[model samples]
Target: MAIASSQPNSPAHPWPSLVPKTGMIVTLLFVLLLLFMLDIALGSVHIPLKSVVAILFGNETGQVAWEKIVMTIRLPKALTAVIAGSALSVSGLQMQTLFRNPLAGPSVLGISAGASLGVAVVMLASGGAANAFAIRQLGLGGSWLIVLAATAGAMAVLLVVLGVAVRIRDNVVLLIVGIMVGNITVSIISIWQYFSAPEEIQDYLIWTFGSLGGVFGSQLAVLAGVVTVGLLISFSTSKPLNVLLLGENYARSLGMGTFSTRMFVILATSLLAGSVTGFCGPIGFIGIAVPHLARSILNTSDHRFLMPSSALMGAILMLACDIIAQMPGTQTTLPINAVTALIGSPVVIWVIVRQKNLRASFS
Candidate 1:
């Protein structure tokens, strides 16, 4: 009172402090809850909020169709968005950290393209013979064959990339190799597309459109298991990943098993990215953009904080995008890839622009 403080930026005596982590967590939980409710309420078929809530709680007496919609359709779609988003985002963060490159992600590494090639082979080059044989012998059908082919293809690419990463010391060069790998795969796919029938080409084209709603309850278990294992593997190596932030020589000096650490990271990334792409199609932009968004929000590059934050932020962003994709007023939904690109590209560009010195800094 006697004298005004000279420090104007002191924030008027700390200003009661920012919200605590617990408060932030609670707020995020509430936001997720609201988003979940919105997802249930605003689908193609109009369901009243009360009925949606009742259906969720198994108390809907006269709303069987609503219950079915909420439980069978929208719930799985929402969960897929959450799980796929978290998995892709966390995987992207791990890749970026391991490579010391902000632009690294599963798609950029051509894992998705590998998966796409696999699907193309199965659907086109395999002569649709495998599908017929599976339906006849094992009772397996169309999409299941595609999923298996995609998963196998993604894993194969992962192995190749891991091998290359171990041999190549430069991250930028490795990235270029990954891009080349993707291009090669695309060329193979194009060849197959040219030789395949129009109907098969249409099917492949539709699959490429990407959709979170593709995973049903029956397939959720497989998706959940693979993603959980992948994430756990990544989480366990947080210490190594953190070490990796310092150059490989520095990590070796610090007693880290550089080769093994790199292998595990690559495998984990492949699993996470592959599983999501296998089930949801090649989801674009989420992996590349979400990690940067998390870094910006947390203001720290620590993997310990960044991974979890990226997971949550990714889930929220993906869920919101899926909701928009549904386009409640329209009968048809927008492609998930398109929505993600529209939302994520600008953010990525901003990150690149704002961090103009990132390349030199990392180098």
Candidate 2:
């Protein structure tokens, strides 16, 4: 691997700046598919991989319960993990690109924080009856409220950030401003918790822990649709994203509207990150950690390859986290957010050790 980097770029690779990242990306896609299948098949009940595949193909697994479990429970959870993972990862990639900061991510920019604030407002302000209200009022459940509120809050904060980004030409200032937004949003959430009922506080806190299984059925479809749209937006902006990699000045000299492109990137990011956070409840770290991992693995900053590669990696990581968190036969599950943090911290440390000039690497 070291030799590959030390030598001239491989001819088989399309991008001259790096090694044969195409093979790695293809390998990742295969791994992601395998993980997706495993996520559905390997659970507490221990359905066989064959049965799972059969169930997915609309064939009964000969056991009613097996079919039900595969179709109803595990399938949706797997799909949720795939979509959420891809969304958060791409969101992170976009933020990292736009900010030209390796550490930038959905949460770093306070978009997730804003989503948290929205959830806090609902669960806390509504008191201990949030669950009942979700099941009763609004007909579609309280989660609908949470999703709407979170998306609203995220979009609102994202808009403010974009407005500021439009006026300010400096990425550093924008980065600090994003941190400040997170701090402010978190402070507000803390105040809400202080005044809320203990039960309400507990409810909000639990939601903050994040969950992949919370979404299923129509909820899963909604997540998939929104994530797909966001991804499409991302692909559309890929060329501009690649251009911006040379820094805003270089992009502008190429007749690219850096500010407008930044706005589109933010919009795509908010949709992707906000929707996932809304449904999954602020699953963190992937948005911060995955892009650098992708860049390091792909050995290039080109968004063309980086976008899909990161999405595939993110889906695999999220599925792996879900598999671990579920604990299979244990009948207990850990919080998804905790797992992400645990997984992400090591990657972050590796990035710090591995990257000499992190910002310049992205550029």
Candidate 3:
């Protein structure tokens, strides 16, 4: 948990600036707070900044509907965006470090793909009137079914990956295997889609597009609880993760439990990815892109800074994307997935091209 000092160093790869890690973290927190507030204030209804602030502080201001809007609708949605955003970002950071790849995230290990497959089986393959009861019995109710199914699917994929990783010693090989598993699951989903009813197919398609506004009450609890625990585990692994950056054998020589650390990381990633996918329907790009953004800002790979900064950066990105998805006026909301990909793809590309020593964090 050492704060990267502000003093300039004479290393082969000095940072572009002399800013302290604390400063970057503080700045990111400020931006995160502002973005979060904006997410709560700006929407189709368009509550004023003052009013939104006042409402949050328990000042009614004579508008009951506004209060309801802030508390019941916008608040939950914004929280979901933040929680899911941060969780996905950390998960991506872990994957990138674990596999030592520039482009790795929840999908890198096919957990989300498995979740999608699970939802497909429930909503598409078993969408008939006769099978509706069976679906509900499996916690695939009209509302939370997709969430549970996605979690189950992600866990299933995670378990398989863990089994393979235990048997196979190569990181590159494990990465490829994860991708292959995802492809196989997706192919099965396609087959399921082809034979499903039109409504079932449409439902599955909508889930893939993603929705942040659907979680609340018990669903929100499940999502929040799982994400919170996952984040704690992720944060705890910062030291081990940093050790991992120097390579496994080097870490092992230092007495770090490489296998146990990997298992912990995988478990945390599964919980974060699974819960978010189950509730939010596989929101993309933030997980894959935000870690690089954090590293570029801090100019260090230290997880102490990278983890919190990536989480905040992710929350900011998600808030902005969620706001854009809401369209800011009238009664229309675009799919969150499209907005994130539209924004995140360019940022990722720019980081790849603009940044020097993309693996500096590892070094």
Query: What are the TM-scores, per candidate, against the unseen true structure?
Result: 0.85, 0.89, 0.91
Q: Is candidate 1 or candidate 2 better by TM-score?
A: 2
Strongest candidate by TM-score: 3
Candidate 2 has a TM-score of: 0.89
CA lDDT, candidate 2, residue 260? 76
Across 187-216, the per-residue lDDT of candidate 3 in tens digits comes to 999998888777678767888998888888
Q: List the residue pairs that clash in candidate 2.
A: 134-142
Winner on TM-score (1 vs 3): 3
Worst 10-residue stretch by lDDT in candidate 1? Answer: 15-24
lDDT of each: 0.79, 0.82, 0.85
Model 3 score (lDDT): 0.85
Expressed as tens digits, the lDDT of each residue in 138-194 for candidate 1 is: 322226667788898887777777778889977677788888888988999999899
Q: Encode model 2's per-residue lDDT on 146-257: one tens digit a residue.
A: 8888888887778778888889978789889888998999999999889877767777778888888868778888889999999999988889988887888999999998
Cα deviation at 122, candidate 1, in Å, is 1.6
* Candidate 3 deviant stretches above 4 angstroms: 1-19, 130-142, 359-363
